[model samples]
Target: MRTSAREVAVTAELNLSQVRALEVLLEEGHFGRAAQRLHVTPSAMTQSINRLERDLGVRLVNRTRHPVVATPAGQRFMHQAVRALEASRAAVEAARGVGAGLLTIGFIDGYSQAESRLLDRFHSENPDVRAEYRQLHWEDQVAALVDGAVDVSFARPPHSGVDTRLLDTRVVTVEPRVAVLAQHSALAQRESLTLDEIDELEVVTSATAPAEWTRWWVIDPRPSGQAVRYGPAVSTIHEAVASVRTAADSGSGHVLITGESVGQRASNAGVVFVPLVDAEPCRIELCTRRSDHRPAVQMLRALADAACSARAKTGRSVQRGAEPGVGVK
Candidate 1:
C-alpha cells in the first residue's frame, strides 16, 4: 500500500506562509508577481518554494516553462492547499465573532462620494461586518468579482459575457446623463442640450473603455441615427475633465456627456455639465454574484437601495428619445 502524499505533507512540517506562497504562485503563474502579491521579495518566494519542495520530498513545480506550472504531485498538494487556505480564512472569521471580519469591496472611478456615504451607512447599520474598499477599472471590477477577489462591486459591469444571472444587482442611483462642454466651446452656455445639438461637437471618452458603453454615454446618435463625431480618447475621468477644461481655453475643444453623479463633483472652471434633456439615465447598480447572497452582501444591497431612494427624491428623471446607445462607459 502506498502512503498518501497529503499525510506526508502533514508530517513534513509545512507552514502557512509556504503553502500560501505556493497558492499565489500557482494563481499568478510567476514568481515576481507572487512575491508582489505577498508584499515580499522574489528571493523570499524562491526560498519558500525551495523549503516547500524539500519538506514535501518532490519537485512540485515544472520550472522549465516560462511561467511555472504545478507538477502532478504539486497539483495534488495544491488541491489540499486550497481547502486548507479556505478553512483558515473561515476559522479567522469565526474567531472575529461577528462583524469583526473584513469584507473586501471594489469600485470603479466616478462613484467615490456615493461609495463613501454607503460605507458609512453599512457600518452604522451593521457594525459587525467591517469593510475595505479597492479602486478598480471598469473591466477589472467585473473580473475581480468573478474570481472572488472582491466581495461586492459598487457598479455593475456595463458589459460582460451574456450571463445575466451571474450577478444579483440593485440600482443604487440613476444619474441623468449630462453633456459637459468646455465653457468656451460654442454650446457651453446652453442651459440644456438637445440630442441633435450634442452630436455637432467632438465628443470625448476614455479611449480604453468599452466602445459600446462610451458611444451610449456621449449620445453618439445625431437624432437622425448617424454616428456622431468622436474626439480624442482620454484614459480616465480626470483626463476627460481636464481635456474639457483645456478645450474651454484652447483652440481645440470637445464636449462630453457623462453621469451627473460624477460631473457634479468635478470643479473645473472650464467645464460645464448641462442636462441631456432627452437621453436615457445612466444606471449605477451595486452588485454581488448570485451565489454570494451572504448577510454582508445583503446588507450592502439594502443600504444601496436606501441611497437610491434618497437620490430619487432629489433627482428628476431625464430622457428624450430612444434609450441611450449602450451603458456606463
Candidate 2:
C-alpha cells in the first residue's frame, strides 16, 4: 500500500484536466454533461477518470446508470478537491486584482436572524461572491473587525477606525422580560407589572452584564439601579427563552427578560409580556463595516439599508392605522 506522502504526491501529480472532469462529474451528475463542460468527448472524460482512479487506487465514480453518483469516500474526496481548486483559482485572481479575497463577516448573535436573511438576498444578486458569517459576542464583534480577523461586521455603534455605515436600526421597547409563570405564581395576574414586583424572582439575560447593560441602556433606557437580577446567565437568546419556559413550566421560577419582538416569535409558547413602567430607552441601530470596501460588502450594506427602509415603512403603515382619522377601506 502507498504511504500518505506517496498518496499526496500522486494527488499533486493529477492534472487540472482530471480535477475539472471530476468536478463537473460531481456537479452535473451526468457523464455527458461533464464531457461537454470540459470540451472533451465522453471517451476522453472516461479515460481521465479512469486515470485518476488508477492513480488514487480508489473508485471515484459510481458508473451505475444514465446519471452518475460518487461513493461516500469519493464524495468526501471530491468536496476537498473542489474546494482546493476554488481556493487556488481565488489565489490567482487575488494576485491579479487588489481586492478579491474572501470576505469574513461577523455579527452579534441575536442580530444574525435578520442580517442572515439580508445576506441571502445579497447572495442571490451577486452569485460570484464569497463570504462567511460568524456569530460573535458584541464586544468581540467590534474587536474582530478591528484586528482584521473579519473583513466586515454587523454591529451597533461606538465602533471606530473603520469606515462605518448604518445597517438595520430598530426601535425596541424595553419591558420586564416577564416570565410567563405557572398559573399559581403570585405575580402572574397583575394587569401591569413593575420591575419592583419581580425583583425577588430569578431572572436571565442573553449575555454578560456589560454587553446586556450596553444594549439595555443604549437601546432601552432603564433606571441605573433598576436592572433585574439574573438567576442563570446564558449566552444565546434561545437558551434564555428556553430556560425561562422550562423554569415556568416546572413551577420553579417566575421571571425572565427578552426583547419586544418575542411576541411575534413566541405566540404559541404560552408566555406573557409585561412592560416595565421604569424601562425607558426604546430603539437600537446596527452598523456595518466601514473600512474595507469590497463589492460584496457594498452589496450587503445596500441590502441592510433596504431592509431598514422596509421596516420603517412597515412601522409607518402601522402607525397610520392606529391614527384616529385614518382607516383602510
Candidate 3:
C-alpha cells in the first residue's frame, strides 16, 4: 500500500519525551541509570526505548553489551535528536512570558551569604519569577548542570579538567582556606597554620568527589615534599564535621580543610577553625552550562556580576581605611 508523504511524516513523528529518553539512555549507557536520571523506572526506560524503536521501525540499542550502546542507526538519529531538543528548549524559553515559569538554582556549602544576597536581588528584580533552590554536593555539582536538572549554580570552580570544560563561571569571591579541627585538638589553639605544618595530620576527604578536588583541598603533596595523611572519607560537610569531632574526642588528630566562609558558619561546638595562611584561596563562582542561553540564566549571571562588583568595591573601601596612614578624607 502506498502512503502519502503527510501520512508518513505523521507516522514517524517522535515526541519530546521519547527523544529525551533516547538521549539520556545513550549518554548513560545503562537502562537503570538512564531511568534514574529521567526519574523513571528501569521498566519504563525499556518501554520508552521499545516504543521509539517501534515508531521509527529500527533497532536503536544493542542490548548485548555490558554497557548498552546505540546501533549505527541510533547514533545517526541521535545527532538530530540533540539538535531537536536544543531547539525545543530555545523555543520554550522564547515562548515563556516574562516573570513566568520556574527557575531552579543550585548551590553548594560555604556560599550562603553570597546565595542570599544574590537571591534578594533576584527577588527584587524578578518578583514574579518563581525560584527553587537545591543544595548540591561536590561530586554531582557539574553533573546536575549537565543533566538539565538546574538552571544555574553557586559553586567553586571544578577541579576536574573535564568539568572545567563543561561550565562557564563568573568569579564572585576569593575566600581564604581554613583548617577545621576538633576543639580539643592541639591545632585548635593555634592562631594560624601553614600547609606544611598540617601535612602530617590526617585530612578528611570525600568518598565520591573528584580526586582532583579532594587532592587540591587537602593539599595532597606538602610544600615540604611530604605526602599528606588521609583520614575518613565523607560524602557531605556535616559528615566531615562529625568525623573531625569524633576523631578529636578520640585523640585521632583528624582535620577538615575548607573555605573560611564555611568555618565561620559552622555552628558545631566540637570544631574550631584556624586559618591556612600559606595555602591558595578558594574562588567561589556563579556557574552555568556554556550552551544555556535562556533569559532567566542570563538575568542570574548579570545579577551575580553586579552583586560581586558591589562587594568588591566595599571591600576595597574598607581595606583603604584600614591601611596605615590612610583614612576617609
Candidate 4:
C-alpha cells in the first residue's frame, strides 16, 4: 500500500539544518569536509547524521570507510533529496519572479514624472517586457524588492538586504518640510513656511514611511507624534497622501516632508512646501535587487547608465519632460 498522506506529512517535517548537512555530506562524501562545508564542527556534523539515522531508522552510510559511501537506500534517498531541494529552490526563484513578468517597478511619487522618462526608454527597447509603476514610500520600495513584489525600485539609500547597483544621483537643496493642506485650511494662507515655524503643528503622516520624516523632519517637539498617535497604519503612499489631505481639510495643521520633486506637487495643490535651509541636501539613489540577473533588468540598468552617462557627457541636468517615451503600466 502507498504511504498515507498523514504519515508522509509526519516524515517530511525534516530539519532544514539537518537536511542541509545531509546535502553537504552526500556531496562531500566525507564527514570532516562536510562539516567544513556546512561551517559546523565535526561533532555537530556527527550529531546531525545521528539524528537523521534515528529519524529514518536506517544506516545511510558505510561508516567504516574513510570517505563514506552511501548505502543503496541512502544513495536513492540522496538522489531524491537533491531533486527535492532543486525543485523547491526553483519554486522559490519562480515565486520571487512574480513581479518579474513585466518588471513590476516602483518609484517615489514626487519623482514619477522624471522616472517615467527613464522608463520610456526601457519600454522602447524591450517592448515585450511589461511595466508597472506604483508610487511607494521609501521603505516599502525596499521591502517590495526583497519579496519580489517590485522588480526594480528607485529611492535614497541605504537600501538594505537586496542587491543594489547605483544609478544617477543628485543632492538637491534641503528646504523646509512642507505642510500639504487641502483646498480649505486656516493655515493655507502662506505660500511658503519654514520647518521651525510649523514645528508645533499636528502632522498627518503614514505608518509606512520612515520615522525620520515625521521625527527629524517635522518641527514638532513630539517627533514621534505620528507613530504614538496613529500607530502602524497605511499600506501605500497614496493612503498617506490622502491622510495628510484629510487631516489638513479638517482644520488640523498637518505637515509632511518634501523634497524639490514633492515640493512642486504640494505647491501646485495650494499647499506650502517649506524648506529647511540648514538641513542636509536629500541624496537620491537608483536601486535594484543584487540577485536579479534577468535580461530585461540588465537592459534597463544599461539604459539608465547610458542616460546618466549622456547627462554627464553633456554636463546638463536630465529633465523628465525631455524623456520622450517612458511608460510604466
For each candidate, what is the lDDT?
0.70, 0.53, 0.73, 0.54
Q: Per the 3 Å backbone cut-off, how many clashing residue pairs does candidate 4 have?
A: 10
Across 1-329, the per-residue lDDT of candidate 1 in tens digits comes to 86688887685544877887887787567899778767899999999999889878999899888778899999988776766655554455445535335687887774646667887877887877767788777555554664456777876336442234456777665667788778777777888887787666677876656555665666555566867778878776778888878765658768777778778777577778888888877766777766554577778878877776776677743221123345224
Name the lDDT value of residue 154 in candidate 3: 75
Per-residue CA lDDT of model 3 for 20-61, tens digit only, reads 888778766789978977899999999988988877778989
Model 4, runs deviating above 4 Å? 1-101, 107-111, 132-139, 158-179, 182-192, 210-251, 263-278, 307-329
Q: What is the lDDT of candidate 1?
A: 0.70
Model 4 CA lDDT for position 262: 61
Q: Which pairs clash in model 1?
A: 99-128, 99-129, 278-320
Work out candidate 3's RMSD over C-alphas.
Answer: 8.1
Winning model by TM-score: 3
lDDT of 4 by residue, 1-329 (tens): 97776675457434545655776676556899778646789999999888877676677788887667788878777666655554454366567655346667777665634455677767886788777777776556565654445667776443432222212222211122344555565545665654444455555554544444344333323333333233224544445456566665665655555455665653444454444443333434455655555677777667666665665566654432121110000
The top-ranked prediction according to lDDT is 3
Per-residue lDDT value at 144 in model 4:
60
lDDT of model 3, residue 226: 89
* lDDT of each residue in 1-329, candidate 2, tens digit only: 64696875467445656876786686557788668646789999899889887777788889984468788868877766765554554454355445644667675544434655776787788777677778776445554554345656655433322212212222211112333343446665766666556666666654533444444422222344454454666665556556666777776774555434443354336455555554432222333334334566566666755665666666631121111110000
TM-score of each: 0.63, 0.47, 0.70, 0.51
The whole-model C-alpha lDDT of candidate 4 against the native structure comes to 0.54
